[model samples]
Target: MKHKTLVLSAAVGLLAPVMAGCGDSGDGSDSGSAIVVGTTDHFTATKPNPAPFDPAFAYDTGSWNVLRQTLQTLTHVPRGGGVPVPEAASHCAFSNGNLTYSCTLRAGLKFANGDTLTAADVKYSLQRVLSIHDLNGAVGLLTNIADMDTSGRDIVFHLKSPDATFPYKLATPIAGIVNPKQYAPKKLRDGFEVDGSGPYTFKAEVKDNTLVKGTFTKNPTYKGDLKVQNNKVEMRVYPDAPAMGTALDKDDIDVMLRSMTPDQIKSLTDKPRKDINLTEMPGLEIRYIGFNTSAPIGKEKAIRQAMAYVVDRDKLINQVYGTTASPLYSNIPAGITGHTNSFFNQYGAQPSLSKAAQVLQSAGIHTPVKLTMNYTTDHYGAATAKEFQVLQSQFNDSKLFDVTIKGTPWKEFRPAETSGKYAVYGMGWFPDFPDPDSYVAPFFDKDNFLGSPYNNPQIRGQLIPKSRREADRGAASDTFGQIQDIVADDVPILPLWQGKQYVAARTDITGVEWAVDSSANYSLWELGKGTTTD
Candidate 1:
């Protein structure tokens, strides 16, 4: 079955506004020339920098955005969206009970530095990802691969089990190939320098947690589906969304890409700025509160269920997020096949204070149940603090719980949360690839991303493996539905809301709507600044 494309809709009511003067019309001057892009996410190699240019070590969305443009993988999701297609490889297939997967590379591929990109380089790059295995990196995605081999131009992978999503996994930037001559096999390459076989090469010097101001020229060695519309692309990093917005309004940046707050999106829509254009696309990004099942407060299933029952998702969507998000009931967000409103089906739309009380009472818990909630203020957004405050009020207002909220920055909170320091904590996810299995498999597996002691044999042993084997994505919906039912019953996490994708660019800039790929990576190649007459 074909995946549904996220239809772009104009905002209604307070959200009612259209792209006033922002369309694909411009003067013939500078047409098909160059463009400059801006973002709030910092791209640097300094301490506390999440935007490491190294594909093996970087996991954040900001880093992936850059890596996607500066690297090439075996397979990639097309801009129009569908199944994964070959990028570096000419074709790929699986055999031997779906255990052995092989791909033959398109001949004469070379790195930006003029190094030959053979199948050996592909095998070495993947091996390096596993060898380094940064705790925060995406090496976990390749755990299914038992072995890798190369014969002539063909790269082969031997999996321990049949995985229908293996090709999709290869399509991600984590599986992007790096030049063996420039990178070490067992350790991550030092510094921010990159030598890749992508559409664009990494350019400019790293300074003060930012890239030096310059344009990144297109890679002549790149052999992929994407064509560089603009020969030169300039990227600038800002400290915050407001700063980025200010720069955009001042004509300092051609486009604003990442980390735009919901309020910013709403403000742009409500005011209808003629100079700026806003495009809303379907988003798979999801935010949730994870319960550390091993912790004191999390050990009790009743406490977890009560917390889920008490969260006011409507308030979160309407108040904090504005019209930028919709209430999500299951781990799998809408737009993906197998998505269901399991939480709503189990509980109701609104918070059930009485039901929460009954759940705790049945567990023989006393009144005023004490619980501490943890969140990251810097990572999620400044609004996260306010959101948590509202949650505290909701839980306390119920008259059955005493909640204490604590927050730390992402750098500190991530380690603490992973170590199970917080009884309950907030987390968000963006898909590595656009697949329903991407949602369920990563979070529910035994060695799950949550780092919380959440283990269900039926889910890990049977349901997930079964879903992975089913070739028909829609047919796998039943297994995913069963998984969501199990999740609703167990209540390891509380689904908050799913976000929508928004990109704001100047009136002269075109192709902002088509910038986002199926995996949600924003492409620099799709953006161009000039008139159609060019």
Candidate 2:
């Protein structure tokens, strides 16, 4: 789910005076120069990842933000949050009892390089992503599609099982259509440029295999559902929140998103800056500890359960995130349908060494179980190291665990997690879509994306399929509740906290709300440096 956890961000209503100073007429008519965006998010583009920006392999939100502006998917969730709507495909639908999905290509579609887009291109794009099956890619989401073919101007997909959420998956960059001529059929293309029929075409600058800057220019040939408000968007990469904040203060960047430290956010929220606009919105981000079930110590379910029981979510959130986040006890966060407090119901409100010990003793686990907590050094923000440090202290304080914490750079951290190098590690989820299935399937499905050998047959087999079958999402709440209960009992992943979305932008920036939509995908096209017409 890091695809979107993949990253965070600003308020328009509080910036009237700031706009006047920037030469905007309170009405939507002025135009400004290219927009520079600063973010703390990083992606792995070194060995094992040759094509960092290729949608076939780019799964994280940072990369998605770049890919989203350059590559167009068949369908996409609306900017304001809604069901999937056409992007590349003029229309798409489920038929033959939801097992078959079909889409008709938008006529006269062309890539930035002028390659005519066709149903064959869509078919080839989907096939290659599945064929490459990169650990960092979104192949897990497409595993359900048994086969697919192009008939005339239409592409048809046959699923192994009935999956109503397939359309939602298509809405993600995972299904972003690639130019067949530019991308190899089976191998990831090597380069730092994109050629797709989206709102913009991107050319990225890389130094030492890490993205330095990515510039998006409006694609004059773009034909899509979105309206391009800005002609160009320049994204600058920062090492951490403090650096990003510095850039914002120096006017080197017009908007900052994907992250700002909680303390930085608090400062802006407590004392409003006349030149800045802080946009606060309901966020679906959740952070958790994933266990490497294949490891010797991690294989012990009782040990995981004990640790879960000992985790003080309230203390963790309060000390590390303050008012920015709330304690989460279930894999599914609160606002999502079918969410339940399974862990809370099982472990109660406070941390209990007694309960933790009891579970360990019952399962014959030795006292003070040895554990090493691992986290990324930079990707998540400045708060991540502190968050895990707090966790180490809490776990050790329980007297039931002997803990050590390790921090690795994201480039190394990601591959290690997928390789099962850590017994237990920290991870965060930014749902791919607003659906609850996005929360569970990616973590517990048979082809779970986390690489932690967590395979619950009940969740993978029954609960998920049952939940997906119901066209009406609310009808599957009971099934999801059961899924959460199993997760609570197994403890494959320990829920930590859910976040509040914050975006910081200069007061003159417009469309902060719509650009960073509910799905957390940034629509660079929605951003403009003036009072945009409604």
Candidate 3:
């Protein structure tokens, strides 16, 4: 969780509007011209993309048209991250007081392969989420769907109980529809091969996760909703931020899709601040820590609480991450539902080792307790190294925990956590949907728990279900409040800080939405070069 994060923008940028790559429309593709978007990873292609391009395997929002594009839910998510609207489904009729929801699918909808997008495909996709739990990220979103049935293109959901908020859930990528034919039932995807009915097709995948775009002139096309500016797009990946900035300076890249720290941006902005456009949106991302209950050192709630207190969150934010991050007390963060001071309401400022020592001493605990902290080095950038160093000092200085720090790269980091390799771990969430459910569900729940396996019945059984049942968000506050309260008590995971995101682009790029910390690529479909649009 450097400690944890999420972003947009406009301006008089450099790179001088190129006729390269068929011009920029939001399809996330570069035409025959091959737009050179630079990421730190050098995302140059070494292999072709893999197909079935599923979101269920890994919660990859970065993929276009494959999972997210081919499928449309009964509803649509809004810009502010609230409610949903009818999408693939023309309309919905909720019976049994919103518990039993029925929907009518839009006519003429079909997959890229020409398979009619049907109620069965929707049923297969949602049920498949529960059927495939080992895939890591797909289990949480489907935990609520009790059962599915089809009547023509209309599918009805029979919930275990009445839940009004289920409609909003259909908008997430986790619940996205996929063709049952191509992908093997339990297999997970490791590359960019995709086939979908979205605005673009998965043409090619380059090295380091850069995606090549193919035309979307197929069934269930969305050409009417999008303005096709370019025929192909290229995503370039770099290993780190400095490398990304270098690419921008060399004009090897057009837009730096996300922002760095204020200082980092100021360097380029001040030199001729007018030359580069820096756009920022605050209060979107949530960063948190789950003390491994599964770990011998992290088993004690008192120790987790102590670490949460002892480590200075504000200092970590200012020094390690610069001004780009905002400290948060709750998992829901700010600008979203279920916001709370529950963490701070329980523990104030920093933790007092004196108090921590007493908690441990009363528990008859031993001092110099050996603790291991794990982090992903390359994934989080320089901020991660700084965060690890700061925490190492904090724990060692506590005189309570004898600590060992482990740093691994993302490739290893991804599986190690799921397999339960670390005592205390770092995790950052990029929300799958705008709703509070997306963040809350992924980390908690008894059966669907992500890691460190913190289970509270009040949450998994009662509170979460009640919240899901309430159509009105305000009515659902008490449920989330209870969830936060229990989180304070269990201390399985510590709340860290929410981050601010910035995207730097040349002055000519346009149509970029500047707000939304949910998913970086969700609205990129609307992004364009040279002009702005709604």
Candidate 4:
């Protein structure tokens, strides 16, 4: 999963496209003037490092949102929900029993800067990300590639194991092809310009080394599967959700997405805006509490289980998120296949002081378990402080635990969480793709994205590998279910609630429903003024 400021999650093993949803007019028509899209998602990039647009380093939604329009992958997740379809590549398939993945580059592929985008460039782009292994980069998801070779127009990957999910990984921004000449092979390329072969080529504006805005215009050199529907897309970064909502209300921006405060959502839902078209879609984003299992207090399974019993997901959703989100019982949120209410199945639907006490008493642990919960201050939203406050209230009210709350900025909070500095911390996950594996593998694997010491040998060694080998992703549901059950029993990460995507665009805006897909990949090419027929 690519980390959003809030965290990110994944989907299927099959290469076949699984189509769902409808909105866009498939015609390649550019009918709209440049439109501004606003969001609260931050564009973070430190100096002397790969810029957020550099796919090799960026692992966040704000950066990927820009990269999606500028870079073309071998394959792409469809406009609706489905498996990867050919983008830069004309065709792609597996051989050697799903261990070898090969793709032939589309004829006459060229970057926006007029550089030839050959298979060699694609090979270099993927390899460089692995070699650099930036801490914030997505090298963990791509560790399966044992070796790769470029033959003429074809790029072949030799996976170390039978991984059917490899193709899905290829569809993500992490696998976005970059020009070898412009991008460094051993380190991140510093600068603002990007040489990509997607529907649009972008020039980003950086203020004090942070991405302020990105202007995307149609690339005549682009020869990919997607057709540009809008002439230009200008993505503007806003300070907060209220500011973004104000921009949407004042018509300063044509579209508002990524995040809106629950108060804003409740207000708009209660009194619909005449000029705004609010479209709600099933979201794959989830929020949860992760424990540092290596920590002294966190190492106790009873404490984790007791905390799970005391957690009130309903109250958290109702008080904090309103109707914008639903209570989540598993890491795999609803809408994705193989999702289960594992936490609810184990801990029941509501918080129970009796159950919390019973669990601790049964484990021979002392009453009033001492614990601390941590959360990010600026990463998620202003509402995050209130959300954690609610969590603290729940924990303290249970009378079975004494909980301390700590809030830190994202930059400081991320390092502390990874270094096992926090006992339990809140996190949000947006999917990398629409697969169950994205939810399970990233959190449960030996080298899990979270530095939590939750390495279950059964899950890491047996269940995940077996599930990845199954070509028919539907058949792997049982394995994913088993994995979720194990996670629920172990109480490594406690699932809290799942979010719903709310996009507010002008009435004349076409293809708003198709703009953000299940995996939250913003398809700027699908957004246009009025209807395509006009």
Candidate 5:
């Protein structure tokens, strides 16, 4: 397949001035006027840091959340969810066999400091990201770009190979444009200062690790898709979900976004509260177990396949996750376009000791295969311990293998997993975008994100590149389906479950359902406090 030509429409002009005021209505009821949000994620800046709010360096979800509001990318995903829309760029397109991508900046655009935003800034920002090449950052996504060119108001990127999803990558926070004058070309900025053209600006008095303190104000010079509903948005950081829930009940916080445990969410369902509103959205998150294929135990395809057959996803979702998640049959979750039940079709829903035994027996493998499963105790959530324990019990009970479970904190576990210190480990994925490619491309690539020695020539060499050339994403579904089937057979990773997005807010707060953007990002712009809903 070859890319011919493509073009995008002009970007929208700057938004008009919005009315802003903060005060409680006098009826002993706080109409949706002001909002205080609670979260477990924290974002801060120190004297000496590698990436202080620099889009190129910031990789964590917390930092990206803040950048999403303060920085404008070339394209953006809509509030509810949909295809990418132009933001900073008036138009973006590809020509000459998908090797060339061109973007035209919106006319008369300027930074919050009144400095002109031009194609040169775009070129510099992208080149800087590539130059820094932070391991923790999303720089790998831009590896396809061979070179970039700049004209009067246009920037062009020449890709090493055809990539249909390249445009979708530009819509992410990692592609946020930075002012060349305010930011250094090489190193990240040191202080807690942001000079973005997004809808909001970070308040100077921001304090991290403090509850109910940090705030962001509407940027007067900003122009984008979202209009700032509240004059000031306060963010409260909590130690755990329980603390966040308590704050929500006590009116200390209007809404809670992330890090809520399944038990906490189940409690809300078990005992309904009139004063609280709970909204759930279909999520693109998937939890899976990655196997180091080069390791002694993981080297056996039959052993991996037997483990998959013996494990029960229903128990994981119902008992461990309290039904907050659904059983996932493939790497691609339900919300994504190419999601399928390939695993289920290959191996039935229930764990079958007989089928697992047959698979191992056919491979001439002995009984009671010794395997150790590694998982992070602190990173995933409080329930991760129980989840791994459940997995341990299932494997031991199957009588096919003797399973030993081990745990480590996320900080240590991440490096260990990436270094292949663990033969088999568990990990979860929160999508970079709500596309089927996001599921397969990253995990199955030659140099995959998992750090596991999983290299499938068919998937890495042919399917991915072929799919990338298909401009219509939906039409590429067959390729993704084939990829998932191949993965199920290879058994490099076992898909466990897919989680649902949940947000618990006070009844007075409107737009709870709309708070989560199409890309699964919690957008503060969609939130409001009042009886009326937009």
Candidate 6:
């Protein structure tokens, strides 16, 4: 119910390890070597998954790394989950109980073409995503904004509903303000035609601009948390993780662009060359199992609860992740406020087969009940495939039931899960903000449950509104605790594990702070090939 879609395993884009080169000082700039990086992206991934180049379309972390550098958001979170600072807007104001919001523009906020970032740009930018109408997960988020009016450097947003969380939504790259004049009104605009205001502007694009570089400016107007580090950044997109790892080992690249699986992390650690280094940060991402509430299995709360009992999360985390990640019972990822281990508290201490069987029998579901599980292949990783298989084994191992596992690519998987074509699928949530409301809202609210999965009244009716109305995020902990209990009782989806953001960098690149998992913006601001004197 948490809008988690199960995608299939993809064989594409995984990278192979590469050898290293010591003397490739990146054009001999103050930042030292040009930091080469690798990702599991094709040289050009135009269709199916939204391309990163287009500001309006991309959801992948790989795309955000490039977008964050090229296009600026209105506000940003610092290295950790700190208060957001201004980027496009120097400061913003919200009146009328968090609905009518306004932002004062920075004096010199201008696009690469030197066009000022005017109020009209902000209005158009916000409207464009709504107009396009296809940016996944954005429609519900933007449901608050009634209209956006821009006059000169002043931008105003009128909300359809009163929401304190709106500003945080504005900070997301999907809601990123752009030079509205360049992006067309009603279609997914990605590629050479797109434009933005950030530290970098697209200087050159090859392989459909999958390989892009952003020129850095003083960005005097950019007073946000995302600071500009190097003068320029060149992003090279590889097809998959293995190749990205290969490139890093060979020194063909500077840092591994994104997080890798436990095994991949191990290979980099065990086979570490002098040049390669590992930077393991607590990630803000959470992955879970979402049952299609629209489906018959979801109709029975007992069946969903049974699924949770049978699947061994500890085994999944330790065996599949190899100590790289921690198993989680709560939808909230670790490190974020309001995180609770509801699953462990309820089931971890004693995974009783007898208890699980008894619970099912009491509910009139006899032994040998069957269910199907699904996943998205390329969306997560090879580890995701193994994860689903583990679930299948977990349930089938229980002589009380039968489990079937299947998956599709992310592109197909999103729609399939949304349509309730599958009974259950592997689902993951990378928060838009670290707030408890974000975790509570997306899955349980009827509108947020895009795939027609499970929804609970405590979460949707009472808990959601109560959480949102509060000015202090931490104030809603009691309600959130109730929401968790409701979820456990409903048993719509089983909580799996919380993930950490893992990136193996060459020793030279330092000051690299991976933004919180929810932001997904890997700006080159805090990054340098090594040290910089300038």
Candidate 3 local lDDT, 63-101, one digit each (tens): 322345445555765443334667677887678877688
Ranking by lDDT: 2, 4, 1, 5, 6, 3
lDDT of 6 by residue, 1-534 (tens): 111110000100111123331323432233544555555543234455444456556655555555666677777654544555667778887798876888878877778777777777777776877777663445566766788877777888888766767777777777777876677777776454446777666554565545533333434444344556665555565556776677776667766655466788777667755565565555557788887776777677777777667777777776687766777888766555566777766666446688788788989987788777788877676688888877777778888778788878766777677767877778877776656667777777755634555656667767787777666666666777888877776767677877766666665565444321333446566666653221
lDDT, residue 452, model 4: 65
Better of 1 and 6 by lDDT: 1
User: Residue 371, candidate 5: how far off, in angstroms?
Assistant: 3.2
Q: Whole-model lDDT, candidate 6?
A: 0.64
For candidate 6, the per-residue lDDT at 159 reads: 84
Strongest candidate by lDDT: 2
Candidate 3 differs from the real structure by a C-alpha RMSD in angstroms, to one decimal, of 6.0
Number of backbone-clashing residue pairs for each candidate, in the order shown? 0, 8, 33, 8, 3, 38
C-alpha lDDT of all candidate models, in order: 0.78, 0.82, 0.61, 0.80, 0.75, 0.64
Question: Best candidate per TM-score, number?
Answer: 2
Candidate 1 achieves a global lDDT of 0.78
Stretches of model 2 off by over 4 angstroms after superposition:
1-32, 531-534
Q: lDDT per residue, candidate 1, 491-522, as tens digits?
A: 98889988877778777776666676434587
Task: Please give the lDDT score for candidate 2.
Answer: 0.82
Off by over 4 Å in 6: 1-33, 41-56, 190-193, 203-225, 267-273, 514-520, 531-534
Q: What TM-score against the true fold does each predicted structure earn?
A: 0.92, 0.94, 0.84, 0.91, 0.86, 0.85
Write the number of the candidate with greater lDDT, choosing between 2 and 4: 2
What is the per-residue lDDT of model 4 for residues 1-534, given as tens digits with 9 covering 90 to 100? 111211122221121112222333444344556878997877655543446667777776666777888888999866555567889999999999999999999999998889888899999889998898765656778888999999899989999999988888998888999988788799776656776888898888989767788899999999988867888988898889889988887889989877878887677677766567667666788889998888888888999999989999888888888887899999888766678899999999988888889889999999777778999887777789999999988988888878888998775777678778888899988877778888987788754668667888999999999988988777788999999999999988988988877777776677666787555679988887763222
lDDT of 2 by residue, 395-507 (tens): 99888889999999878888888888999899988888887898898888865678767887888878899888877677788998999999999999999999877788876
